[model samples]
Target: MMTVIGGVDADRLLKDRHRAMWALGDYPALAAEVIAGLGPALVDAVGVHPGEHVLDVAAGSGNAAVPAALAGGRVVAADLTPALLEAGRRVAADRGVAVDWQEADAEALPFADGAFDVVMSCVGVMFAPHHATAAAELVRVARPGGRVGLLSWTPGGFIGQMFATMKPYAPPPPPGAQPPPLWGDEDHVRGLLGDAVTDVRVERRTLTVDAFATPEAFRDYFASHYGPTIAVRGAVSGEPERAAALDADLVDLARRADRGPVGGPTVLDWEYLLVTARVAGGSTA
Candidate 1:
């Protein structure tokens, strides 16, 4: 049974908020220009084959879905934000590929049990508030012996640190909401999928981001284009001093982590965790 507040399902309300938050950003641009390689990388790792039924959960703008379809698989890209789904549809259309784009919540996917040959999320699903529920959904929708792949930002990565930097100024998370970075922890994920999967493989990889020219560029871009950062900035927008402090801190973080030449482009190696495993035969619940 779902908890209800003011006649609305609490979880549904949260999902609605999440949908709006993601819709706030120019994520399609971010995915295409910066993190575009992630989807293909995860698809390659999962060995998505021709004619396979592939599902990309929390798939923002067809990151993995587009590539999976191009690999000759029938793909479905599911996300909470309709805007992102529309954007993904456009991308697929432009690529001359077909993908079934649907609005779906990662924690409660609208799919049958054992419905897909490949279930994956590239830097997606990790943002679902309830980690355990989302993990179970991932396993549940995969056919027995089907592959499950996930790519998430590590707790110690540049993106993780950015989240940490923003935490001080952000609003409190709802009850039962877990930190997104925990999905990057091997032990945490293993426990979440325990006994339901086998032949698990984990890899730590880095994505080199050089899109921003300087620390301020990184800060401003995030403020305008990243949903979470935009939300944080909005939260502090009314408080000018705190907002300025956040701006300064974000710039400082980028400056400290920048690996490029003393005065050239900003080079940041964002680390992430990649996990793939075969679903063990039997009922997934």
Candidate 2:
């Protein structure tokens, strides 16, 4: 007895789960708080200003974009998925804030040269066609005098452990799977930035995200929100049934998940990389 979600792949996986891909509620407010705390630390680090034209790339639901606009900057929120762009627009509107929402790919943008005074992306980009191209594109769109910023989850620390904790229940990742290092790791990110960044700094921060009222809640959250990860991954490569089976396996594993409280603060170890590099005309540094 097997069912499938049609043919899905990584892209399809995202497509299927875009709705569930949403960041948790209060995260938007929390994001603003994070920015506030890091804002002073990143003024020079990220070159943000009150009036700078900014683009929040992969700006799912405009959480960061709306706040940036409220801070008095003309902001545009862009993302690959039209669905996400639509969600972002609604969010901006709900907040009574005006923001330009656009559908664009990070690997290649349809904007003009030096289109933004400041370019920033949060929690997105690692899934792009190529991280190098995406990083370079950020530089390409920013004016030489402008700044490029990215906020990414720091890999292999508290956050890493969090993911690690869930790995057993996750669909088997590809072989030799090495996740890209995130912003918290300076040397790694610097290397990723190469010479494009004249200066770089990693501001480390963490927060307590509500884990779940019960393990079942966490399991259901992913089942509904994260999409059937296994099913989607298989469909991505055109093997729905395989993924479907894995999907069941995943849920089954979830039932066996550590039985704990229905509500508790699961401190998510996360890092927001606010590296502000003065755009160097011709490099990926």
Candidate 3:
């Protein structure tokens, strides 16, 4: 049932199910190998400085959180999954940085208004299911004139197409769930954050990925390690033909996107949207 939490409309059941889905796969591996650089990149973009209050929403395994902490900001890494939080703790510990890890729903972040100086997510908050709510929460928690930064996969990017490819085989999305890739669209995000923020700046960036040796290898890796892919595979597990078709489609997507030497390892340039804005009002101390 949908319930208002922290003044935001949130579906408890959907949040619970989402937590479970994210906890299923070996997400730490995926984060460490595929998108480890995003956190630092975002932190830098937001100009995180020593002793600023920073919040990393939907920070799976503390990707951005650890880096923020390392940069000397007082960082809080909040996510829906406890397992991921624990993993993030270990990561921070290993890096010799301290971060406050908490379980938090992106749509209903448990924080006071203007609680942070910099609110950021590295390809994280875009998947909150309710884009407008999540976007509002991001704004609400940032002090006036504070920064809000986000990195999300573009709709035309490899990851976006992969999600699209999985939709045909996966179960119906829960009510109020917006397509995550919409976060990458500049107009969509500006509309979501309308009139609440100022100095909105967007940059289109590309991340080079070459972790897989082949398209088939990329497909197999995602199937085994990515939560969304694993969930889709499970949805079609009862039908071998459907599962096989998905496998083929994933390979085709990767192959088509690959821009590597012929007969060489797979190389893909994943496009993403980087957005940074300031909450409209007086500066925070």
Best by lDDT: 1
Q: Please report how far candidate 3 places residue 7 from its true position, in Å.
A: 21
| Candidate 1, residue 105: lDDT | 86
| Residue lDDT tens for model 1, 113-194 | 9999999999889999999999999999999989999999999999989999999999999889999999999999999999
Quick one: ranking by lDDT, best first? 1, 3, 2
The models' CA-based lDDT, in order, is: 0.93, 0.58, 0.92
> Residue 274 lDDT in model 2?
54
Q: What C-alpha lDDT, on a 0 to 100 scale, does residue 131 get in candidate 3?
A: 94
- Model 2 scores a TM of 0.67
Stretches of model 3 off by over 4 angstroms after superposition? 1-10
Counting only residues 3 or more apart in sequence or on different chains, how many pairs clash (N, Cα, C under 3 Å) in candidate 3?
A: 0
TM-score of every model versus the real structure: 0.97, 0.67, 0.96
What is residue 187's positional error in candidate 1, in angstroms? 0.7
How large is the C-alpha RMSD of every model relative to the true structure?
Answer: 2.0, 7.7, 2.8
Query: In terms of lDDT, which candidate is stronger, 2 or 3?
Result: 3
- lDDT (Cα, tens digit) per residue for candidate 3, span 18-91: 89989987899899998888888898998899999999999999888999999999999999999999999999
